[model samples]
Target: MDKKPNHRLAAHMKEAGASNKGLARRVCEVAARHGEQRGTTHVSVQRWLDGGGIQPQTAAFVAEALSDKLHRTITPTDLGFPGPVPVTPTAGVNYAKSLPEALSVLDGLARLRPEDDPPSELLLTEADVDHAALTWLVSRPDGLSNDSAGSRRVGMRDIAAIRTAAGYFMQLDFQFGGGHAHKAFRHYFREEVLPLLDASYSAKVGTALFGAATEISQLLAWTAYDSGNHTLADRYMMSTLRLTQVVDDRMMGARILANMSHQANYLRQASRAMRLARAAIEGGRAHSTPRGMALFAAHEARALSTVGDHTGAGRAMNEAERFFELADTGDDPEWLSYMDEAELVGEFCHCFRDLGKSREAVHFAERAVSLTDPKYARTLGFCRMVLAQSQLLNGELEAAVTTAGLAVEAGDALQSARFQRYVTDFQHAVSVHASNSTVQQFNEQVRDAMTQMDDE
Candidate 1:
C-alpha cells in the first residue's frame, strides 16, 4: 500500500503563504535557537509534505516555527504525524483534565509496546509544561467514584504491597542506577499494580490506590530519565501528575513538576525549566512541608543559574537554605525524606558550577560528598565528579586527577548513564593534560572500568 501525502501540512503551508524553502529555513533558525543544529532544507520539507515524516525533535522545531509564522499553534498532529495529537486551546493538555480521560491515557500508554524507533511526534513541550502549571495552580479536588464493575476486590494489603515494591525499586535505583531497575519497575507495575486499579474498591480505597500508583509512576519516570529515555520519562511523569491530581495530592504534583523542571534544565531548555520550577513552587505552596519547599526552591535555583540569572539564582538558593533550616522531617512525606542537607548542598554545587563559580562549586561539592550516605552511591559518585571538575576549573590539576580517579572508581559499580556521562565529561576536560602521568593513569583506569562494565 502506498502512503498518502499529508494534506493537512500542505494546506497549512498554503494558508501560511510559506514556500518549502522558506519553511525549512524558518525551522532551521528556530532549531538553532533551541541548541539543535539541523541541516533541514527545502528537500526535507518536500519529503515531509510527501508523507515522509520528520524526526520528533525536528517536528517540534517545525511546529514552533510555523506557529510563529502563521500566528497559530501548529503541531505535528496537524501535519498528520502519528502518536498523540497536540493539545489545543479547545483541548486540555494531556493528562490535566478529569479522571476518566487521564485513566484512558494511562491505559493506552501501558498497552503500547516498546518501540525501537523514536516516537512519531513530540507531545510534550514548553507550552505543555506551562499549561500544566496553570492547571495545577487552579486545580480542585474532584472526587473519583471507585465503584468499579470488575469482580476482583482490592484492599489495603494490596496497596501496602505496591508501596513496598516501590520502595524496593527506588533503593535499587539509588544504589545502582535507573538502567538496572527501570524495566523491573515497569514489569512489576504492569503485572502487579495495574490489576489493582481495575479491581473493585470503595472511593477511599481507590484514592489510596491511585496515590500509591502515582508514586510508582513518578519513580518510573525518574528511572526512565536516569536511563536516558527522556520521551518515555515525560510520558510516565504525565501519568504521575494526572494520578496525583486525581488523588488531590498537590505536594506530589508539585514534586513531579519540579522533576520536569530538572529534566528541562538538564536538556538546556532554561526558560522552560524556570517556568516549570516556578509552577512547582506555586502548586506546593499550601500543602508542602518546609523540606519540600526547599527542594522546589533548589530546583528553581538550578534553573535560574542555567538561564544566567545570577541574582535570581542566589535569592532562590538562600530561600532553599532558609526552608531547609526550618524543615522538620516529621512534617515531610516519606518520599521526600531524602532531601536533606546533603542533597541541598549537591544542588548548590551544580548551580555554582553552571554559574562558573569554581570555588563555591568545589566547596559545596566536597560538603555534599562528605554528607551523602554510602547507600546513595550513585549520588556520591556524581558529587565526586563535580568536585573534580571544579578542582580542574580552579587550576588544581593534581587534585582534579585524583578526585576524578575516585569518581571513576565509585561510578564503576553503578549502571547509570548519567554517571557514565559525567565520567566522559571529566575525561574530555582532562584530555588537554593527557601527557601528565596522573591524567594518563586516570584515563587508563576509566578505559579498564568501561571494559569491565561491558563485560558485565
Candidate 2:
C-alpha cells in the first residue's frame, strides 16, 4: 500500500527536540549502529526536506535508525509504504509514537503560505529557534559530507545567487509592501535557505552567508516595523547589526545603524535615533563607498530633523545629496547600492514631516512616491499617510482624509502591525477636528482597520 508522503521529517526532528543538525548526527549514529558508515550531513538532510526524495536503501537505513533510537520496531511501512523487504529487528520499544503526528506538522509547515498569518496553533516561542543564528550555526555535522571536488574558494557564482535573491525580495518588498512580502520571504530564509547555508559554507562562504542573512534580517525588521511590531522589529534590527559586523562589511554596518536609528525614532527616542544615525554617518566616513556616505547622511538628517536641529539637518541633507550625485553606476556594494534617488527623497520627506514643515514634506513625499516602485506599496502608503497629515496641518482636511484612506488601502494586504501605529498617528492628528464629518468618517475607518489588524 502506498501511504502518505514522508513529510514528517521536520516535524519528527522538532518533536525529537533535534535541530536539523542534530537530526543528521543521530541519523549518522544510527547508521553506525547498523555497521554502515554513512556520511549524513545536515545538508543532505536539508536537501531531503527541500524535495530531494530519499533513495530506497537510505530510506530503510533512516527508518531503522529512527526506530531503534525511538525504541520501537520501526519499518518502512511506518513511513507510509508497504515494504517488499522484511521488517528489521529492533532493540527496544518505539521511541517516537508521535512520529506520525510530527510528520503531519512538518507536512503542514511545508505547505504554509508566507503571506498568511502564522498559525496560532504551533505555540513555538523565540526559544524554539533563533532564526538569525541558523545561517551561521546549522552547517556540517563533524563527520558529514565532504565532496569538495574543487578549490575551496568563495566563488562569484555563489555571491551572485545571494545578491540575486536579495534583490528579488527587496524589489518585491518595495512595490508590494514589506508587510506583504516579509512574512513569506522570512519564512523561507528561516526554514529553508538558512539551514542550507549553515551546512555548506566555508569561511569566505560563511562571510557571504552572514551578509545575506543580515540583509534578510533587516528586511524582516522593516516588515515588522511597518506592521507596528516594535519590539520584534528592534530584535531583528539588533540581530542584523550583529550579523553585519560578523561579515565585517563596514558599509553594511553603517546601514544597519541607520536601521536602528529608524527603530529608535519610531519609539520616540529622538536622541537615541540622532546618536545612532550620527554613528552611522561617522562609521561610513571611514569605509563607505560614495553611495554609502550619501545613505548615511540621509539617515542622519532624518535623526537631526527629529530633534529640531533644522540647521544641522539641512547641512546633512545637502551633503547627502552631493554624495548621492557622486554615486557610481558601476559594481556597487550590496547595502549601499540599494539606496537611490527615491529612497533619499523618501528620507527627506520623513525629515520634513517630522520637523512640521508640512508643505515641504508633501513636496518631497510626492516626489518619492512618484519614483518608488509599485512593489514598495507599503513605503508609498506610509509616505502617503505622512503626506496626508502634512496636508491636514496645512488645513486641507478633505485631502488628508482621502489620502489616509489610500494609505489604509495600500496596507490592507500586509501582515505588519505597524499599520496600526500609522493609523493611530493619523487619529491623533485628526482629533482636533473630531467634530468635522470628514475627520469623523476617517477616524471610523481607521478604527475598523485597527480592529481587523489586531484580530490577526
Candidate 3:
C-alpha cells in the first residue's frame, strides 16, 4: 500500500490521537532520550503538512518515536513511505472568528464529541437561565466599551483571564484539597454563571461567555475528580462536553475524551480507557495536529500497559515517537502549548511503571520529575508515588517509605484526593510485608500520617 508522506503519517497520527504541538512535544522528548536536539514548532509543522516537505533525515526518528510511545514497532511502510523514515503530519486547525462567535464554538465543542451526532441547540436559552448577572459577566475585556470599543481587538488577555482564574481555582483545590471549594465553584458555575449567561447574553457575547465558562467548568470537574467525587465529576464532564458543543472547538472536544480516558484508568477500566483514548485520536484526525496525535498515542500506551499488554503498549510508544521526531517548531495552537518532551517522558514513566519495568520506571520517573515545574505538585506527587511503589517492589522498604512520605506531603499541599489515594495504595502494598519489622513500622507511619491529615 503506497501513500504520500502526509497521508501515511496523518493516518497513523489519527490512530495515535495527537495534536501538532503534542507531536512536536513527543518528538522533542524522544530526541532528548537519544541526547539529540529537536524542536517541533507549531508553525514549521503546519508549513510541512501544508505541502512543504520536512527534513528528510528526520523520518526514522518519527517511527522510533511512535514505537517507543505506543510500545510497538512501525515501519516507514506502515506510514506509507519508503526508505528509513516517514514525515509526521504537522498541519493544524485554527478557528478564526470574532471573540463572541469563537466563544460560542468553544462552548459548543466542550459538549460535543466525534462519536456523538450534532445537537440542535448547543446553548441554553435565556428562559432556561437567569439574566440578572449576565450583563456584568459579558462586559468587554477592557473596562471601556463606550468610546473606541468598535475598533478594539479581542486578544489573549481575555483568554488569559479565564485561564488564570481556571488555574487559580485548580491550585486552590490542590493545595487545601478538594472539598467545599470544588463544590462551591461548581455551584457557582451551574447556578450563578450558567443561568446568567443563558438569560442575558447577546449572540456574540453569549458565545464568548459560554466558552470561558466551559473551560472553567472542565477544571472544576478535574478538581472534583481529584477529590474522589466521581459522580459529580461525571456530571461536570457532561456539562463540559455540552459547553464545547456551543464553543465549537474540536481540539477541546477531543480533550474531553482525553480526560474521560484518565477517569477510566482511575477506575481500572483499561478497555474503556483505551476506547476513549482511541476515539480522541480518531476524532482529532480532521485537525491533524502533532500534539493531538501524541496525546492519543500516550493514552493508548497507558491503556495497553494497564491491561498488561506490554508489547502492544511498547509498539504504541514507538508510534508516538515517530510522530514526535517529525515535529517542527512553528505554527502551533495555544490549546496544545502545554505539551513537550517532558510530558511525553512522563507518560512513558507511567507505562513503564505499570509494565513492571522498575528500573526503567525509576529512570523515566526521575527524568520526568526533573523536567516539570514545582507548580505541578500533583503530577510530581504521582511520579513520587509510582517511584515509591517501584522501590517497595525491589525490597527497598526504607527508600519506599521515604519516597511515599514525600508523595504524601506533596499531596497534602496539593488539591488532589486522587494522589492521596495512590499513596494509600502504595501503603497497602507495604502492608503485605507485615512480617517485616521495617515494613510494619513504615505502614504505621503511613497510617498515622494519613489519619492526621484527615483529621486536619
The candidate scoring highest on TM-score is 1
Alpha carbon lDDT at 309, candidate 1:
85
Which is superior by TM-score, 2 or 3? 2
lDDT of each: 0.80, 0.62, 0.59
lDDT of 1 by residue, 262-322 (tens): 9888778899889889999988988899999999999999999987789999999999999
* Segments in model 1 whose C-alpha atoms lie over 4 Å from true places: 1-93, 96-98, 107-123
lDDT of 1: 0.80
Which scores higher on lDDT, 1 or 3?
1
The model with the greater lDDT, 1 or 2, is: 1
TM-score of each: 0.77, 0.65, 0.61
Q: RMSDs, each prediction?
A: 15.0, 12.3, 23.0
Candidate 3 lDDT, tens digit per residue, 56-131? 2234566776676667997645654334311111000122112333323323333322223223233222221112
